[model samples]
Structures are given as C-alpha cells and as structure tokens.
Target: MSTTRSTRPPRTLVHPGPSPLSQRWRAGRVLPLVAGLVALVTACPLLFVALEATQSGWDSAERLLGRPLIVTLLWHTVSLAAVVGLATLVLGFGAAWLIERTDLPAKRTWTVLAAMPLAVPEFVHGYCWVSLFPTVQGFWGAALVMTSSLYPLVFLPVAAVLRRSDASTEEVARSLGHGRAAVLWRVTLPQARPALAGGALLVTLYLLGEYGAFAMLRYTTFATAIYTQFETAFDTASASLLALVLVALALLVLLLEGRTARRGGRVVREGSTARPGRPLPLGGWTRPALAAMAALVGTALGVPVYALGYWLVRGSSTTLPSASIWALTATTLGYALTAAAVATAAAVPVALYAWRRDTRLARALERTAYLTRALPGIAVALAVVFFAIRYAQPLYQQPPLLVVGYAVLFFPLALTAVRSSLAQVPHGVEDVARSLGTAPLSVLRRVTLPLILPGLGAAFAMVALTASTELTATLLLAPTGTDTLATQFWTYTTGLAWGAAAPYAAVMTALSVPAVLLLTRRTLGGTRIPREATR
Candidate 1:
C-alpha cells in the first residue's frame, strides 16, 4: 500500500493501491501456486500408475508381480543400475581429476572428448556396440553401453566442481603432514561429494527409466516389460502395476540419494578466500593416465563413429532419397524445438519460486517436478494417453499431445539448467531493481532474464537434443504418420536394415554435437548441476 506524498497533498493524502513490495509478495504466492500446478501435471504419470494398480486389485497385482520374469527383470534393472552407477562414479571422477588436479596433456581437448559421449544418443551407443560386435548383448553389453553414455552425466558435474572448488583444503592437509595421496582422498574427494552425489543420482535415475538402449541390447528390464505389455499385449493393468513397482523403486532411490548426500556432508567456503592449488605433476604415471583416457574416449566415442563409417562404406542400402531424410529431419526439429520452448517456459516459474523463497512449499514444488525424472518414458506416454483420451479427447494422438509428452518427460532437464543458472545470480539483484521503482515484469526482463540467458540457452539446447533423439515416448505419443529421427532409426533397425538406420543415427549425432558443447561449456564453466539445492 502507498499514499501520495506531496507538500500540498500532505494534508489530504490520496490513497494508492498495493506497493511494489506488496505486489511482489502477492505475485510470489502465485508463482508457487503455478509451481504446484506444474508439479501436479507432472505427477499425472505416477498417479495414473497408482490408480491403475488400485483398480486392478491387490490379488491381480500380486499374481502379475510374483512371476519368475518379474523377479528376473528386477534383478537385471537393479544390478545393471548398481554396476553402471559405480563405474560412472569411478570413471567420471577420474577424468575430472586428471583434467583439473593433475598435470595432464591437452586438458582442454581431453575435457571436450570426455564429454563427447553425450553427443551420441543413448540408443546410438547401444547400436554401435552390438552392431560392431554381435556377441555384445545381455547384461555385460547393456552395462557397457549405458556406462559409456551416462558417465558423462557424472563427469561434467564432478569436473565443474573440481574446476571451481578451492584447493586450499588440500594444501592445509599436506602442510599438516598428510601425504599427497592422503590429502586428495581425505580433502579433495570429500569436498566433491556433493557433485558426485548429484551426478550419481542422474545416472541412476536414467538407468531406471531407460528403455530403447536396453531393448537394443536385448536386456529385459521393467521398462522393456512395461513397453511390451502396452505395445504387444495391450495389458494396461499389468503395465501400470509394473510401473507402480518402478515408481516405488524410483522413490526408494530418491530417499537413498538424499541420505547418502546428507551423510557425506558438504564443504563450503567464502568465495574470496578460496583458491586452486598448483596441479600435481604426474611423472611415471603419465603414460598410464594417457592410456586410460584414450581407452575411455575410444570405447565411448570411437566405436560409434567407426560403425557409422562402416555402414556407409559396406552396406548397400546406405543411400536414400534426400527428400525423405530431410522431411524426417524437419519433423524432428519442429517437435524438439517446441518441447524445448515449453519445458523451458515451465521451468522458469518453478525455478523462480524456489529461488525467491527457500521455504518448504517452494522446495516441495521443486522436488515434485524432479520426481517425474524417475518415471519411464513409456509410462509418461501412457499416462498422457490415458488423460487425453478421457478429458482431452481432441488432443489424443495429436501433435500437441506429443509436444506435451516431450515437455513432461524432459522437464527436469530444463529445470536443472534453469535452476543452476539461477544459482549464479546474486541474491537481491532483482529486489534492487524493483526497489528503484521499476515494475516487477520490467525488472525481470531487464535484470533477471539477462542474467540467466546462458541458462535459458543451455536449457533449450539440452532439451532439444534429448528430445530429438527420444524414442520410447515418441513412439507412443507422436501423432500418426509422424516419424522423428529416432523412430525412423528404430524402424529400420528392427527390420535389420542397419545401413538405413545408421544414416539417421549419424544425423542425430551431428545435430546433437553443438548442443552438447554448449551444455558442457555453460554447465561445467559456471552453472551448478541440480541436486538437493533446497537442503
């Protein structure tokens, strides 16, 4: 509230409406409300799963879940995720250390190479391995492909933390008679626990919901089973029950991640007082270090390039009509760009709500959005179909429905990018602008948005790349007669036309490379990856 202040009007002040502060507070309340709505929208899949399970009755669920195949799938999913997460931790942390802490050669080139695996789509990684080596199938093959592709999720975060972290703690430990190895183990690793945990959560959650990659490797996980039930058997009840179990598994993992991160603790220091110590010189160990980096990049990146090249050279069916390929490319780009914009727009309110008010409500809203991360793409696709058919009949199987599905499935990616960008912005900047009598909207446009533009670009690129290569949800949610690059690749691969599939995969990799570079530069350079920011 405000009142006119003038010498003549002082005797009879004119009343004004809400002040900027009051208006901001009022608007702040609405953002969380919007955030809450977004969370509810995202939860549709989880709720749909639960609803279907409940409607199916407990006895039916028990009958379906007690099968040998269910147990087998459970073991496969859990074991593979455990192994991959562990491998990713070691590989990611090692690469980050080599680049940031040790005197390694060509650190800049190595950094880019280390992150290059992500430029190749996940399914492409699987296809590359199994195509080159037919024996690469089942447990070991799935683990290899997933580990190679997902390790970068861990690597980028841990690298950023190591790059920006203060090395004074290590110096103090060394001065106190600790050996170099001891200091690194005790001080450096501990300081990086948060980054490790953040990266691990992403890897683990992804492994849980992953479908196409596992399917390509002939691995039978819950995701594959769910997809089979929906597509082949048309058993919605069985699929939902299985998805409920998956949801339970996801929530359990979330709980464990929180406890593990909290237990590990965090090392915080004043920015001005922090400094990086000199890099440790690697003498005799340099050769082995170089070899390790070489082998990693080779397996993760080289095989895919080699396989694509081989298909082009050896396979007779590699050539295709240029118009068809370009048409599919346009369709993929259109949907991906739409999803990227929608997801980024949705992220702003949730990110802003949490950033402005670090309250339980804000945090809950934020986590609610992240909870969708654990869901399989097929489950999300099914849920959208369920709701659309019932309440939004017009949107069922329409392009808009596909766009919504993409937005829902990949919203977390956008949120991570946006939230991390928001973290770099100093608190009180927006308040200062508004306090100077600038309207809230004007302040956001001129002050806040400008500050987080890098994040917006990162968010758009990340979502676009991921969405473009998406297969599981796109297969289910995309409108009739529409084929993205991923779907086209899947179509040809299933028909044993490896050469035809290779071209699509190559195109996807080409499109994704720039986005991967932008994401790496923005995320690893300054922005923080998403974690338990509320805590």
Candidate 2:
C-alpha cells in the first residue's frame, strides 16, 4: 500500500527499434550519399578528360584517330596485354599447381618467393632490366618485365583456390577412370576458373593502365602515347582523346572478364567440409619442377634483388648526401602514408554501400570508382592537373593535390580489400544490433571496425606500397622542388646517373618488402595444409 502511494515518475516509453529519423538516415540516405560523393571524386579525372575532348571538337579527335601511329599503338597495346595475360595465367597456374598439389619441397619458401615479385613495381622491374641491358626496350622487353612483375597476381589467387578446394570431386573423377591429367584439366582447372579469371582481369587492367614500365621500355602503348602527348606536346586535347581510347580498351577488357567469369561460374562443393587430400607425388618430375620454379623465382624475384644489390654495391662510392637521402625517404613515406590513409578511408563508404545496399546505384558508384584505375596514372595525374589549375588554383602543385591524385589512382586497391572484408561480416549481426537499440555509428564502431581491422590494415599497406612507387603521377603532381624517392630516382635515372638512383631504388625496394609480406600473409591465411603435411 505504501509502495503504491509512493508513485514513482512514469517511465518514458522507449522504442526497441531504431528511430525513424536514424533509420531513414542510415537505410535510405547516408550510405548512398557517401558512396555517390566518393564516386564523384573518383570520376573527376575521367570527367575532365571527357570535357577536354569535347572542347577540342571532333576535328581533333578525327585527326588523332586517323593517324597510323594510333593503329600501331593499338596493336602494341593489345599484343602486350594478350602476351602478358597468357604468360601470367600459365606461370601462375603452373606454380600454384606445383606448390599446392604436388609434393614440392620447401613449399612455404617457394610460395613466399613466388609472391615476392609483387613487392617490385613494374617500373622498378623495367628499371632493373633496362639498366642491365639498355637495348631491352620494346615489346619483348615490356612483356618480360610485366610478366615478371604481374604473375604474382595470378599465382596468389590460384594457389588459394587450389588449397581450399575440396578434393572429393577430383577423387570421384579419378575413381571414374579419369587419369591425373584428365582430372586436373577437367576438374581442377574448372574449379579454379574464378580465381584465374579474376587474376587475368587484374593483369589485363595493369597492362592497360601501365605507363611507367612501358615508358621505361620505350614501348608505345595507348598509355605511353597519352604520357608522351602530355609531356612533349602539352596537348591536353590529344592526350584526353588518347585517354578516352585507353578507357575504351579497359572497358572492353572488363566486359570480356565479366563474361568469362559468368560463363565459368564457381564449382560448388556438396558439403561444408573441406578435406585436404594427399599431395600428389612428383616422383621423376620433382627435380624438373623445382628447376622450373627456381627459374621463375630467379626472373621475378632474383633479378630485381640482384639488380638492386649490384647498383647499391656499384654506387657505394657515389656521393649521395645522407641528408638528401633521408629527406627524400621521409618525403616519400609521408606522401605514401597520407595517400594510403585517405584512400582507405574514402573506400569505406563506397565499399559499405556496395556491400549493404546492393542497389543498382550502389553498383554503378562502385564501378565508377574502379573506372579511374583503368585509366593510366599519367592520364589521372594530368586530369587532376587540369582540374586543379582550372577550378582549384590553390591546390596546384600542392601536397593535398598530390594526395588526392593518389587516392583516385589507388582507391580500387583499397575498395577491393574493404569490400572483401565486408562480405565476410554477416548482415544479421548489424540488424540485431539495430534491433537492440544500438545506433548505426555505434554498431560500426563496436562490431564492424573491430571485425575488419585486419583487412583495413592490409589495404592501407597495399595502397602505401603502390603510392610510394608511383612515378608519373608524382612527376606531374608533386610540388615544384619537392622530391620523393620515385621522382628523385627518375631524375637520376633519366640523367643517366644510375649510381645516384640506386640508393633510392634500394630503399624503395626494402620498404616494399614488409608490405608485400603483409599482403602475402593475408592472401595465404585461408590456405589449409594438406593431410599429409599435418600427419
């Protein structure tokens, strides 16, 4: 009775569901808006190129397109892409099969070595090879350098798929009287098709956008043509026109890859259990396989290491001021760090929208973000320069401009990592959190961020590694008198001061090793050991 008389203040009703305003903000507007903004930023360079092309009128376009040189460039570009794509496919698939399926000795060591070339940028590879053999400039040279630099893209994914693949289907095929070769050709390769397609797409894209490597090798692809136009002629119209053609080529590759992937589709294992089977005995093939792998490692990883070492040793007497070296290193690190952080952060919204919304608009935005990457870095940098000079004069030759350019060029790398990480996180968890009256930001902070931390770190490291070695963009965008390691290396190399460039190149390579290790570890993390190894 007394308790009843003591009437406490009426409890305020609280809805368990998220507030209507918050729901509208998160479910309806926020992600799409953020994604759109990111997409718009990424599309700026492409838009500028388009605008410049329009302003130049059809006459300039026709004149440029009518040129015999354009045809030559197109042939060269297509040939290079085809050669590199096929070479990478073969090398990557073969290496993955040997390491994952056979009783290859030092599998772990081989795996790491196989992936090590990823640390060396295509430009660096070109520099190494070209420095050793100055005559190495043209199709053969470009193909050799690009294949060595890019094969890891194929190897990593194929190796991963091979490791995780359930061998039951393969065993069944074998029991059905299929030979090892038949099973491998029909069962194994088909299952690995998705990985192969993805890796091939990446290689093709790299060839399309590649400028530094092609430029160093004196190969005249569309990308190199655009760079030459910008540098020599200062003809924005011509460069933009060429860039549009390059974009078309890239889009063509994207379409082909999409169709191939869809046609191939994934092979669904019947059950959740994945049993790693016994490793295939190499027998008489072991020595030959090992020798083959050794040759691959020698070309991809060994050559670059030896080249750098030789340069460093040869340049020991060269007077590279300690202060200047440290300064350049610091500058390179700072720019790379800034670009990495900005790109990784910028990627989150688009990645999140793509992962969660699954709308046409979201898909378009995500695709648009990737479109810039398909453009050469030279094109991207020039577009940024054009935009900065026209609209944002204050940003001209500024570090911020350089950083933004880096983000545009490398955002795809971060997006790929972030989207993949987001895919692994279940949507139901976020829904549960929202139902429990947690705010969207709170859910992200508590559940999402913690879950995707490893992925974010990997993304950051990858973007940083790429930005540090970026040559054309840095050359165009870096503030006057500012020298990053890449620009400094280019200056010395261009001046035929190979010795002076060596220290910078060596340091760049050294810094890249850690990032490469981080990426390889993340890639290989999903791999399970064969039953034989565990035994």
Candidate 3:
C-alpha cells in the first residue's frame, strides 16, 4: 500500500517590506518643517494683534476703560453673552427634544424651519425684527435676535444626538419602576449634555464677536464698541486695544469651553444603540405648541422673506442698478469659489497626514490649521490687512488676498470634515493596496480620493457658504470698488431705505439657504442612513 501524500495547509504569503521606523524617520524630518510653517502663519497674526494691543499705550486704553460708557458697554456685552448662552441652552434643548423625541407633527418641516434662521444673518434678523417692532433693541433685542439666529446651532447637534440615543436606557429605567420624567431627568439629559454644552459654547463665542445685529440695534457690546472706535474715533490704536480685550475674553471662553468639551467626551458615544422612544403625545398642549411653533418660524423666516421680497420688487423701480448687483454677485462668487477650493486642498494634506501618518508633528500641523477658526473672521481679516499693506502691498485689494483670508478663517471646517470622513475608511484596505506594490502617492490618489469625495464636497459647500455670507472681513478687506451682497444690504439699510435694501438681503438670504440646507440635510441624512450604506 502506498503511503498517502502528506497534506499541508496553504503557506501564508508574507513579504518583507520597508519598516515603518524608516518611513517615519523620513517623514519626521520633513513634517516638522511643514508644521513650523503652518504654525508661523497661524500664530503670527495673533501674536501681532497682542503686540499691537500692548504697545498701543496703556494710557489710551486706561482712558477708555475709565469712561462710564465703556464700563456700561463692557457690562452689556458680558450680560448679553451670558443671557444669550443660557437662553440658547433652554430653547435649543427644548425645541430639539420636542421635534426629535416627541410625537410632534411634521418633524422634517420643523427641522428645516428651525435651521432656516441660519440663512438669515444676525444683522438681517435684527433689521427685520426692528422693522416689525421698534422696541426690539438693546438688551432685549440683542438677546432675542441672537437667540433666534443661533438656537439652531444648538438644535441641530442635540437633535442628531437625540435621534441616535438608545431609548432602551430610558425604557430600562421605566421598567425598573422609574417615572417618565425621572427617566428623562436622570438618563436622557445627561446623555445629551455634551452636544448641548458644545452648541452653547459656539453660540457664546459667536455672540462675543457679533457686530452687525448688536450695532444696528444700538447695543453697545465690545464688538460694536470696537467697530465704533475704529469708525467714529478714527483711532486704530484704541480699536486695537479694545480688540485685545475682546481677544482675551474670547480666549477665556474658549479655554473653559475646551475643558467642558473634554469632560463631556463620554457623552458622545459612537455607535447607535436602538430606535428612539416615541414622542409623548401633547394632546392638551397641541394647540398651544403649534401656535408657538408658528410664531417661531413666522418671525425667523416669514418676516425676513416678506421684508426682503417686498423691497427687492420695489428696488427695481429705484436707483439700484441691476448691473451693479450682477457685478457684485460675480465678485462674491469668485471670492467664495476660490476660498472653497484652496481650503479644501489645504485640509486634505493636514487630515491625511494626521489620520494615516499619525505623528507628533502631523498632529501639531493639523491643530495649527484649526487655530485660524478660533481667531474669528474679523481678527483674521484685520491681521492680514495689516500685514498685506505693510509687506505685500501689491497683493492688497486683490482677489488672492481675500481667498487667503477665507482659507485662514475656514480651513478648519474642511479639515474636520475631511478627517472625520477619512477616519471612517478602513486601514486594511490601504494596507492591501500597499502590499500589492502600489506607491503611497498612487494609493492616496486612487483609493483614498474616491472614498473621501463626499466629504470634500461637503467641506467645500461649508466653506463656500461661510465665505458668501461673511460680512465683517469682507467689509474690511474687499477691493475698494467691490460690493458684496452683504455690503450692499448694509449700505441700503444704513441709508434708511429699507425698501431698497430688502432685495439684496432677500437674495443673500436666499442664496445662503441652499448651503444651510446642504449642511443640515447632509448631516442629518448621514445620521439617518445605515452605516453599511455609507461605507
């Protein structure tokens, strides 16, 4: 009898490849240089702003600080930020819970309506509400207008968290003999706290830098004060001094907010647990609830639309020329498009290097990109203007300057989006391609590019939207002859011709809606869709 041939398991394929140590060492040297460049660009402006503030002579700074009006302005700004922050937390959480958790009718419509105010710039809302009621100014007007415009920032994030939360936790609490109210108080709110807190922090920071609405309403906040000092006083030194104080205030908020954000890390759990519980029926409260909803939407969306539309129709008969509008529109589109492209491109390397090639230097570079967003648009624009005029005078008043300003102001949005999308991609796939002899550059171009296109699109859309709606920086840095829709609206409104200003406001608002819709829709759509489908 012949002995049976021994059978052996298929030999695993193994290849000796370049070691990671060698690759990392190579990247380490080059990455630090890139990181240094990024840091220099991002930090130089902040440093300059601080230097100017300190050097502007404390005598003037102290003189302004001694004035009663300045003290009152300080109080008003702080109070507005505090009150608006609290109001946003309450209104945002309540509205989000009602629309997302309760059996409220027309959840989708409510979502769209709630987020629509973002399309209406804070200034426009202030203008419209002021038009409707002259008393809506000062503290009450600032708070109401800020809340109406910003509550959505809180609502969107909280609603997303609410939709994905495991209702099973609440059900379990109820099964253990807890009441509905108890379950919510003990379980649901704790889970949603992080999103709420983060949203509140954003609202606070925005309020800190707010200018248009507060200024229009005759509210003397730091933002308005800084603008006034620059405009009325004809004193760059005092404005810089005030801007320093503003920056300090902003940094303080950011520092505390960062700690809170870190502490709430556990609340933002990754995987969804189960279908959310059905909304409690508002049987007796339905009429009152519906009426409240109507009022919210009517004031935020309806008034702006009505005022803008009425004025736009009437502007055709006035001195506002169509050619001027069209020209500004093209200028605005060019600035926005260029900014979007540059920001998206810059974010890719930062995100990719951070995600795939994690290293100390890479992470630092990524953080540097984000530093720009924290500085606020006005600071960024002003810093650039200062430097551009002093050093790169030829480039001043050029489109390229505006594009750079946008990239500096908005690269973080693109970086976050791209990095998040890249994180969702599997590393094993990249390994497989590498093992098949694909070059690193080729792999990134072919494999990573296709998967992250949606993120790039989303990022571009966001940057484009912000650039289009941007008022402060655009106001300061736009070419002498150029007028964006935002600037045009401001001009007409300031001239006491609400009828003429309405069209530009309406068009600007209308243009902004598509981007807001894209943001909310894509964001919520991603949450609603199955993860497997996303992959």
Best by lDDT: 1
- Write one digit per residue (lDDT tens) for candidate 2, span 1-535: 3555566897879756758456737665777787898889899988988988887888878988999999998899889889999999999999999998889999988989999998887888988999888998889999999999999988887887787788788889989999999998889998887778778888888888888778789888888888888889989888888888877887777667667766653543323487777898999999999999999999998888888888888873334443388888899999999999999999888888887887788878877776777788888898888789888999998899999999899998898878767766778878888778777888888988898787788789989999999898898899998988888788777766676788888888888999988867755676321110100
Q: Candidate 1, which ten residues in sequence have the lowest lDDT sum?
A: 526-535
lDDT of each residue in 1-535, candidate 3, tens digit only = 8899999998879876766545545555664565456556656556656776776677877887788976787798788889988887877787778787677888788888888888888888888877657798878888888888888877777777777677777778889999868977888787776677667766876787778888789888777777776667766666667766766676677556556655542332344345667677888887787787788778667877776666566653345444376777777888998999988887776677777677776756765554445454566787888889888999999878888888777776777668767766777877788677666666778998898898788788878877887787888788887788888877776766777777667777777888889767854673521111111
The regions of model 1 sitting more than 4 angstroms off are 1-15, 264-271, 318-323, 523-535
Error of 2 at 466 (Å): 0.1
lDDT, candidate 2, residue 90? 97
Off by over 4 Å in 3: 1-24, 28-36, 58-70, 265-274, 313-323, 352-378, 419-438, 526-535
* Prediction 1 global C-alpha lDDT: 0.84
- What C-alpha lDDT do the candidate models reach, one value each? 0.84, 0.83, 0.73
Among residues 3 or more apart in sequence or in different chains, the pairs in candidate 1 whose N, CA or C atoms overlap within 3 Å are: none
Over 1-535, each residue of candidate 1 has an lDDT whose tens digit, in order, gives 9998666634657778779888787776777788888878877888888887788788988888899988898899899989999999999999999998999999888989999999998889888888889889999999999999999988887787777677877878888999977987888888778778878888988888888888889999988998999899988889888887777787787777777677553544324455768999999999999999999999899999999999877774634333377889999999999999999998898888888889998877777677787778988998999999999999997999999999999998898888887887888898788889887777778999999898898889989999999999998898898888999889887776788788889999999999989867754565444343311
Candidate 3 worst ten-residue window by lDDT: 526-535
Q: Count clashing pairs, candidate 3.
A: 2
Query: Which ranges in model 2 have alpha carbons more than 4 Å from their true place?
Result: 1-27, 265-271, 316-323, 527-535
What does each candidate score in C-alpha RMSD? 4.1, 5.0, 6.5
Ranking by TM-score: 1, 2, 3
